[model samples]
Target: MNRISIIIPMLNEADHIDNLLTHLLENSSKENIADIIIVDGGSTDGSLDIVSKYKSISFFSSPKGRAKQMNLGAKYATGNILYFLHADSFPPKNFDTLIITEVKKGHEAGCFIMKFNSNHWWLKLAGQLTRLSWQACRGGDQSQFITTSLFNNIGRFNEDFTIYEDNDLIARLYDRKQFVVIQKWLTTSARCYYTNGVWKLQYYYWRIHLKKWMGADAKELNRYYKKYVC
Candidate 1:
């Protein structure tokens, strides 16, 4: 009977927030959801107004960084499990039941494999690879869920990271062998890739992952992302 708190960190995401929230409400039972919390990073795109109108959801403000916003939402969550999701990603139907089922089975941390909303062959292949439990295939777009106790134990997402925070947290989970990959798929927006060009965007993304693995500092990593991806 553990409830889930869906925490989303967003900035200028008005274009996607309403539909995403509606999908979540329609697909999951209110009884299984303690609350949906939207932690805004000073959004100026009317995203705040949209979230505020949602029933049974809480709204909070935070400094403009993904990690900081998510951590802030975690602090205010009341559910036993915290589900961190992207504003542009949509989980499968009955995802709440799936998460509760896995948690009851003792899988404390995990995420659904994700497919980009693109028909491109490379994107399809990338999505397929996420079905494997290998660490290399994981990313924030897939969305993450972890027991509140375990999240507290691990000290939560590193605020030092302006980006790549999800991978950083997943690396720790992997180190402790405390992660799993649910077979279901979350559909994430491919807007970034489309806007930046699929091949070019992916190259920079892969490079960032490599740099992080090679011990690049958070500042250095963010610099590269801003220069290349943003």
Candidate 2:
């Protein structure tokens, strides 16, 4: 039987963690889930206290990086499939069954098409673009699901990247032609766009993607991110 282990890497997400946990359990069948692992990257906002209240979830502390945190959680996961989610993203109803259905259909890996929880015109346009098969439209907020064996075979999420780790993994999956886009909507928080202004944040993201394509290393990418996004 294929069971999915949901892995979430978060830092200082105290505002959303509890609600996200509740939403996840309510949307999917517990029988289809092997475990829900939450890996924290040194949170100081009492996120740990909030997470500990959920007995079904397995929580651990790790060095402050999403890639590293995800890898650690994955190492302890016993499920045949792994679902990597963002703390502020919510998948569609019966999301586990949706993923398992795709897997059973011979699709090795995929993510739900995503929308931002906002009404901004630009963001709406961005969400619409995600429906395309082009990899340029992809981002981490889509919530990736992959078979554990295939995940390991791809060398897992690249720990060397402080950013663009998701893109890196997705790019590799695209290279192998092992990727798909489920025709469902996942809603992700647009808090970053709100905090940084929509246009500014979007521009920064585009620049980062361009830099990565132009042969920038992880350290260089980190520098650009720290300079602008952070």
Candidate 2 per-residue C-alpha lDDT over 106-183 given as tens digits, one digit per residue, 9 for 90 to 100: 998999999999999999999999999999989889999999999999999998899999999999999999999999
Residue 136, candidate 2: C-alpha displacement in angstroms: 0.7
- Alpha-carbon RMSD of each model: 0.8, 0.7
As a whole number from 0 to 100, the lDDT of residue 25 in candidate 1 is 96
Model 1 residue runs over 4 Å out of place are none
In model 1, what is the error at residue 15, expressed in angstroms? 1.1
Work out candidate 1's RMSD over C-alphas: 0.8
Candidate 1 clash pair list: none
Residue 178 in candidate 2, Cα distance off native in Å: 0.3
Measured with C-alpha atoms, the lDDT of residue 126 in candidate 1 is: 95
Per-model lDDT: 0.95, 0.94
**TM-score computed on alpha carbons, candidate 1:** 0.98
